[model samples]
Target: MTQEDKINWLKENEPILWANTFKIAKGELSDKQTMFCCCGKLATGLHEDNCRKFLQQVKNETAKRLQEYIK
Candidate 1:
C-alpha cells in the first residue's frame, strides 16, 4: 500500500498509535520516550509489527520531504 493508505489505515484502526507515531516522527515527542501498545505491551518503536509499518511510512514521508528540499 501507499504511504497515505498506510497512514489512513493507522488513523482508522489505531488512532492512538497513529497520533503518537506521527508526533514522535515530527519531533514533537522525545525519541527516548517509549511507546506502549493498547494492551500495555512495550513497543520497541521499530520491531513491533504495527510500529514497524508505521515507521516505514514515516521514513517514506521523511524521504519525500528531503527530496523536496533537494529540488
Candidate 2:
C-alpha cells in the first residue's frame, strides 16, 4: 500500500498510534519520546513492534508529502 493508504489504515484501526505517529512525523514529538498505551500505561516493550511499524509508516508518509511538495 501507499504511504497515505497506510496512514489512513492506521488512523482508522489505531487512533492512539496514529496520533503519536503523526505528532512525531510533524516534529511535535521527539523520536526519543515514549508513546503511551491506550490503557494508560507506558508502551515500552509491550507495544514496541507495532509502535515502530507505525512510526516508520508515518515517516514514510511525511517524506512522500515533502517530495511531492518539492516537485
RMSD of each: 10.8, 9.9
Per-residue lDDT of 40-64 in model 1, one digit per residue for the tens?
Answer: 4675544444555445556555444
Which tens-of-lDDT digit does each residue in 1-71 have in candidate 2? 66666555656766675566566564533344467643345656545445665456556755454443331
Worst 10 residues of 2 by lDDT: 62-71
Instruction: Assess every candidate by TM-score.
Output: 0.38, 0.36
Cα shift from native, residue 33, model 2 (Å): 20
Scored by TM-score, the top model is 1
Model 2: residues with Cα > 4 Å off, grouped in runs: 28-71
